[model samples]
Target chain A: MDPASILLGGFASGMVLFIVSVGLSVTMGLMGFVNLAHGGFAMLGGYVIVLAMKHWGLSFVPALALAFFAIAAFSVVLERLLYSRLYRAQELDQVLFTIGLVFVMTAAVTLGVGPETQVIRLPDWLRGQTDLGFMTYRTYSLALIVAGTLLVIALWLGFERTRYGARIRAAVDNRRMAQSLGIDVGRLFTVAFALGSGLAAVGGGLGAEILGLDPNYPLRYLVYFLIVVAVGGLGKVTGVFFAAILIGVLDFVLKIYFPKGGTIFIYALTLILLLARPHGLFGKRGT
Target chain B: MDAPHTAAGQLARRHRFQWWELLPWIAAIAAFFAFPTYLAFGTQLLIVILFALSLDLVLGYAGIVTLGHAAFFGAGAYTVGMLASQLGWNEPLSGLLAAAAVAGLIGFVSGLVLLRTHGLTLLMLTLCTMALLEQAANMGAHWTGGFDGIPGLSFDKILGLFSFDVLYFRSQYLYVLAVLLLCFVAVRMLVYSSFGQSLTGVRENLLRMHAVGAPVRARLVAVYTISAALAGVAGGLFTQATGYVNLSVLGLERAAGVMIILILGGYGRLYGAFVGAVAYMVLEHMLAKAYPTAWQLGIGVTLILVALYARNGIIGIGEALLRRLRGGGQA
Candidate 1:
């Protein structure tokens, strides 16, 4: 593949990764909770979209919306019942609880979907490639880049400018202080979790073209998403984006150039980055 | 081994060595020895018991909550399988050693990276390591046989005498049982030693341990590496027993299942790993047989309940019940 094509693919992949990591970044950044089940939500969203498209005959937009709503609702339930209990618990509890949710979600999907690989057929309009000046790329993929960029902008504005964003930032910085100032910290947490979940669902829908809607895709993407989060630092939105794009470019370059030893390259890069900046590329000290 | 004189210490000592402790071990050994006469289920249980024991080294003793231990185990199994199948290294001891070495290397390298971060970062790091390794293995389908797995793994004799048969699982059970006993003894000795205490110390208070001049990071890395080696041994045994190596060995579900076993047995106790493994396999076997479609739901519900109510695991609950019964008798 040409450099332009690789770059485009990397950009598309990076956007999807950004969507996934942002949710994780916000939750970890805002709350001291390391919610491992965020990946499970992504898995749930992917499976839902695939089912809607293949079995229910729903179009892409409707299916995407449905998946997002479903994941958001599930996030609310998770937040209210289990995550709420875990907020005060240690990191281990958060991990174990989320790990349990992963098992339950994966098993449930397997039972329902029969452990077979399910492919989502993109609509005819979005199926073929469109030729740009530099290179030809899939229309869906280019659309993903546009959508992802818009979402990033929207998220930044909401979190950096909006009143709710101010509350969330306040709560994240100091929960007790936020509560003292009469912010509904509990409600804010739920909303934050829902937003994270919603973002993951949208990422799942968009990245389904590249990753495919496999029963095990969530677990597959988990390491990549986690590397992005770790490399960007735990809870910073800007950090997640920069980390995701860097990783995306690196992953694509390796995969295209050295398919045999791509993983080695990826890991080697991570090691170098981590050794140089343990707190992450843009993460503050003591994080 | 002498009991401390303090009231709390005396109570702890008594609690540690109850008669029921011996009963289960005795019953399990007796049943295992007699398993050849009954059925194949006992042998399967034996494998899982060993796997759980390996996990307990890190989870119970070192207080590390790893979600991807199966990487070591699966790597060991694949290494042994590839060697035995392709290179024709049929000697079980040699295969086991190779497995241990490979797993130890991976463990040592990954531990250096993972042990740097605590809490969620550590968990994610381990998970990433497992995922990366699994993908690498899957992509290298020619050598590792990809997703179809390395099949036709055959062994001539375990120690140049015992022949491995597919149908008759009795000798296999004995073979795994013997290995498990050796490992159990090794782990027990380690736990009772000063090294084990150091590991527990690191787990409890790394800062305090460092303050006291203990090399906390080194000790953690050592334990992690050793635990991975033991897991490799278990993986070798698993491949030998099953006569096949599959990608499922390295799957996320497999790792999660092992974690569930650790949680079920009780963390920080040697016997808990064995009990948890047996309990998990038994529950899975029975539940799958009863309700194949929704067995996972049952397992999920059980895990939730255990996490919510049974903080210490089955072994802890058993100890509490025994204490209650003994106190009632005294009353």
Candidate 2:
């Protein structure tokens, strides 16, 4: 592969990772709950998209929107029923609970969809390659890059400029202050968790073309996403974005150059980064 | 400090064990030795018990919520398998030593990174380490035998005396039991030592320990390394017992299962890990035999109930019940 192509591929992959991980970062930042089930939500989205498109013959756009909404809805129920109880519990309890949910969701999917690998076929429009001046790129990947960039910008503006975003920021910065100021902190938490889950779902739906849909996909990606969240710094959106891209790019470059030791290379990178900045690349101290 | 002294006082009280307390444990070990003939499943249970005990050393006693404890176990198994198949080291002791050494080194190195972070970060980092190792194992298909796993690895006599036979499950069970006894004693001694107290102190309050001039991080790392070594020993024994080593040993599911075992037995208690392991394996065996596919669902439900209601696990619940029965006349 050309250097440019590798870079582009890295960029595209990073965008997918960023989308998947930012939700986890947000939830961790806002709620201080290490929601390991974030990957489950992503898997749920992937399975939903695959099922909707393949079995129900829904179009990509509708299926993606439906999957996003479905995961968001699921998150609401999860927040009310499970996460509320877990918020004040010890970190281990939260982890165990989320880990349990991972198994349940995985088993549920396996039971419903069987264990076979399901491919989410892209539409004909997304199947073509675009002729750039220097390199030819897949239209869908390029489209994803554009969409991901737009999403990031929108998220940035929403969080930084909007009143609801300020309320969320206030809640995250100081729960008591936010509540004292008459902001509904409980509702903010639910909304934030829902948003996080929804973003993961979106990432899952979009990247299903590349990642593929499988029952074990969530467990596999869970650590990678967490690494992104951890390395980027919890609750720091920009940190997640940069960390995801760095990891995605590094993973791609290493995999292409040293296929045998790609995983070791990734781990080595993480270890180095962690040693240098234990709080992560963008995380603040004590957070 | 006060809590530690109180706990030490409680430990002293518990050490004055009645004849009945000793009888049950002795009978349990005896049954473990002799019960393999009744069912081949008992041998498998023995190995799992060892695995769980190794976990308790770090999790239960040291208060480390490690999700990657299986890394050492898997590494140990792979090391033994690789050594036996490639290097032709049929000596089980040498294999076990090699496994333990390698696992201990990895544990020590990673513990430096892991011990820095508390709670969720440590949990996630350990999981990452395990995941990374599992991927590396999978990627190194030629060396580790990949998904199909390394087979055809056989052992001669364990320590040049005990012959391992596939048909005779009794010998294998005894071999595992002997190793388990040695490990159990060593772990018991370690837990009773000052080092063990330091670990508990670190777990209870790192800041206070640090302020008091205790090397909390070093103690934690040491405990982690020791736990990893024990887990490695268990893994090496597992390979010897089964004549197979697979990548699934290091997988997340196995790690999660170990956590479940810790929960089932009761954390911080030496024998809890053993009880949890036995219960898990027994329940899994029975449930799988009966339900086949949905057995995990049953296990999942059971774990949820245990986490929610039975905070201290099955052993704690049993002890509570026994206490209630003993005090019934007073009430």
Per-residue lDDT for B19 in model 2? 67
Candidate 2 lDDT (Cα, whole model)?
0.81
DockQ of each: 0.31, 0.36
Model 2 chain A is weakest, by summed lDDT over 10 consecutive residues, at: A89-98
Q: After superposition, how far is residue B70 of candidate 1 from its true place, in Å?
A: 2.4
Per-prediction TM-score: 0.87, 0.91
Best by DockQ: 2
- Identify the runs in model 1 with alpha carbons over 4 angstroms from their true place: A47-59, A110-127, A131-135, A170-184, A253-261, B1-4, B8-18, B33-41, B82-88, B109-113, B131-149, B320-331
| Cα lDDT of model 2 by residue, B139-234, tens digit | 888788877789877898877887887876667777877787788778878887889888888778867999999987778889889989988898
What is the CA-based DockQ of model 2? Answer: 0.36
The TM-score of the first chain in every model comes to 0.94, 0.96
TM-score of 1: 0.87
lDDT of each: 0.79, 0.81
